[model samples]
Target: MNELISPKYQMKLAADVEKAVWDEFGSYKNVRNYIEKWYEHDEQNYNWENFRVVIRDDKNIDLNATIHSMPGEILLKVAIDLGVDTPDFIPSIPTFKNEIKSEYKTAYDTFTKAYKQIESDPSTAIGLANSALESIIKEILKDKRLKSKIKGNETLYQLSSAILKEFNFSSTEHPKEIKTIGNSLLTANQAIEKLRSEKTNFHGKTNEDFLIEDALYAHFIVNSVATVGLFLNKFYKTKYPKSEPEIEEDDILPF
Candidate 1:
């Protein structure tokens, strides 16, 4: 069964199965009884033998191991019965906005909207993804007191370069590999901006204009945003760690 399903899907299914078993049934014995009842009434024809061997042991069942070893199809059925939706195994963008110290709700919301509309409206998704990245960069710059360096109408590439320079990411002092990665990130940001303007419906495209219609392109852009956003955030934090507030001796009460 593990050999049949991809590792990503297997992890997602295992997590869903564990959640359903614990949240809905509360215990393995209860879920086993529920499945047995279904079998008794001919409600489901799922092969009980495989499930029984993993779930019906007398000792405390190794739930994690059991879930991982269960057949993928059977686990999916259990997930459905327990009211858990089948997991969509896709690349997940990290919540890079949370790492910012200042207001970032808009950027966070925009990124979420971009992720949700990736399949339904790829053009809008790409546009929103680009906007989210720009918003994040601006927020970071503002937080670091570097927003004044912007010339009011800078492109995504320019903004990224400014922030990267602030973090010394574009410095010649770094290793060759780091320099290559930084250059690549700058290029990716530029590409995303280009895609949003020329390949999307963001600027009111004409009928003759080419628009991105495939979700794969949206996925690529979103992931690119994720990569660049995360790199910027981590590098910024490393370069400028937040200072810990000093406790006042006068304010401290005697224990």
Candidate 2:
């Protein structure tokens, strides 16, 4: 179950558009308009960037397709694959303004929610982040491309670095650190599944695939949410300190 809604990919897409604009005409007035229009169009066809091309051991298999989503009509189509009801799903083509609005608000809402939650419970934040990261890594490791190359947790971090780089983060601090702080969530999930298979009342006797899928989805979601929260927290705390100990007006240039 590939979770399709990716804010990280969306951010990279916007950045790429900005760079392309800069390279073409220097700059544009707030890419919001362009972004809105792009969303209005389908995004399924959007080509993924920042992906590695891996060579299979067989040497005959070709896995050259981009792993990311696209802009315009393409992305909208991808949303359908999620089993989400859209214009294509309905004959009347129900207005999706609400859906669009919700989509737009998701990241900001997640950031705010995570921040407030973190402020009240720092331990919770760290725990949730670790749990989520572990889950995502488990799913990733299961992929044939990754499974073949990765022998242990160390190589998994290397893969995480490659993926996280697309989101503009370095693997040195949080990436590798997160990987080391805990083992793969897959192991834990598998253990739980095995216990459940034994019909252990303590394990709740739940569906294994559903449990793993839920964990994997939550893993990606929580990390992205926590990451945005942390970034915003640092930005505000550093830039707008409650106590002004230093002053340098020139440090910030006037827009």
Residue range 91-155, candidate 2, lDDT tens digits: 12123222222323443333333222332333333334343333334333444432234444543
Model 1 clashing residue pairs (backbone): none
| Cα lDDT, all candidates | 0.70, 0.35
Off by over 4 Å in 2: 1-117, 147-159, 162-255
Backbone clashes in candidate 2 total 15
lDDT of 1 by residue, 1-255 (tens): 235457788688789778777777777677555555433222365533554334445665556776676666566455544545432533336344444325567777887777767766889989998888888788778764554466557788888888877776667789988888878888889989999889999898888999999866776787778767877877766777778999999989998
Scored by TM-score, the top model is 1
Q: How many residue pairs clash in each candidate?
A: 0, 15
Q: Which 10-residue window in model 1 sums to the lowest lDDT?
A: 34-43
